[model samples]
Target: MTVKAEPFDLSGKVAMVTGAAGGLGQCFAKTLSAAGASVVLCSRDRDRPELVRLANDLAGAERLAMDVVSHASVEQAFEVLDEKGIQVDILVNNAGVAISGRAQALSDADWNAVVDTNLRGAWTVSQQLAKRLIEQSRPGSIVNIASILGLQPSKGTAPYAVSKAGLIQMTRALALEWARFNIRVNALSPGYIETDINREFLQSDTAAAHIKRIPTRRVGVAEDLAGPILLLASAAGEHMTGSNLVVDGGHSCASL
Candidate 1:
């Protein structure tokens, strides 16, 4: 008799992903769901039709309306899970916003918006997951979507860069504090993904010039992130935590 061995499959696992309506979020959701995990797509635009299509395509995937900046909203969102007896085995804090401007020209509102969503949002969602995982005696994984900007500064993106830097530190702190609960936390800092966010900019000569600096000589696609996202969320990365994985095509390394 042969005993069947399991691989990195996430069957029976439940995943909650923030920012599920966007390109990156949709990629992660589709990848994880394809790998056999029940995915919960959370975003402020839960009513959007695109989300409905995503939910239908991915087995066991669903959508929830969530605003990460509001603590009261977070609590209320979690209450639904509590009622359903759903415990998340994986959490991806993939929601973020970017604001670009010279340091002096950046408006206070823009700065606040970037920080509140990129940094505070990740922290708040992680807190919500940590509390539930600890109380329910569940072991889980958390992958926070940071940026290469977090590791180094990019010109004219002070607010966006600063928030990502903060997220890396927050992921480290959470990993240390929650290790006892068997919860792993880490960050993925992707570089120059060709998504809705930068499509127009990349089409211009100036933007194309900057993109050519990458060793790959091409911008990343949304699907380029799917494999890395799954590796961190599934059993394949069970031993890794508090580490920031940089997926930039060497753009951050070039001097010129």
Candidate 2:
């Protein structure tokens, strides 16, 4: 006999999405909210008009200021959540920065900046959230937004690749350590996605050449990640901790 599958429902869940002011972060917040979770749209600057507008527009959505690079900032954000009696049941660590430059010419500042935000930042936020879940004896989920570059190297993306690779490993380590507490940790590695910042470049001839290398022969959009993200964030993925789900339109399958 086959058992009925659980629904991918997040009703009554509270999800915190970092860097939700724009881009993929905003999309993540919107997706989670639509699935019935009360979303906390977090950005380094919560006072941005767009963020405020989004928070007000989405039912059961709120905005908070959080800088994942700073432990103090992460702590303060959680403290505010505590004051409001909001416990985080899901976390989307999507705040990241990419500094493209030749590895030989990369400055200490640039390398540090990328690593700090991409790796350290995720750690800071995840640690704080894990602590809260442990204290309350509740189960939770964490989805780290990684990249295809993490699995393979590319030109002028050394630091970014390194950071993402580290994050992937960190996901496994955290999942192993936190399993007893019922906190699942996983990584979501997305391929090249056309966003406001990269749209022009991605549409250029130079990008066209790169696109040919992809098996799918097309770049992904932010919405392409919605299903994978929601699966990892909800009960449907309860047994999926320590996995790195790659949604890159077959970019990683091509022979380099």
Worst 10 residues of 2 by lDDT: 1-10
TM-score of candidate 2 to 2 decimals:
0.96
Residues 103-213, model 2: lDDT tens digits: 999999999999999999999999999999999999999999999889997888899999999999999999999999999999999989987646777877867888999
Model 2 Cα RMSD, Å?
1.5
**Highest lDDT, which number?**
2
Error of 1 at 105 (Å): 0.7
Model 2 stretches with alpha carbons more than 4 Å out? 1-6
Model 2: how far is 164 from its true place, Å? 0.5
Q: What's the TM-score of each model vs. the native?
A: 0.95, 0.96
Q: Name the TM-score of candidate 1.
A: 0.95
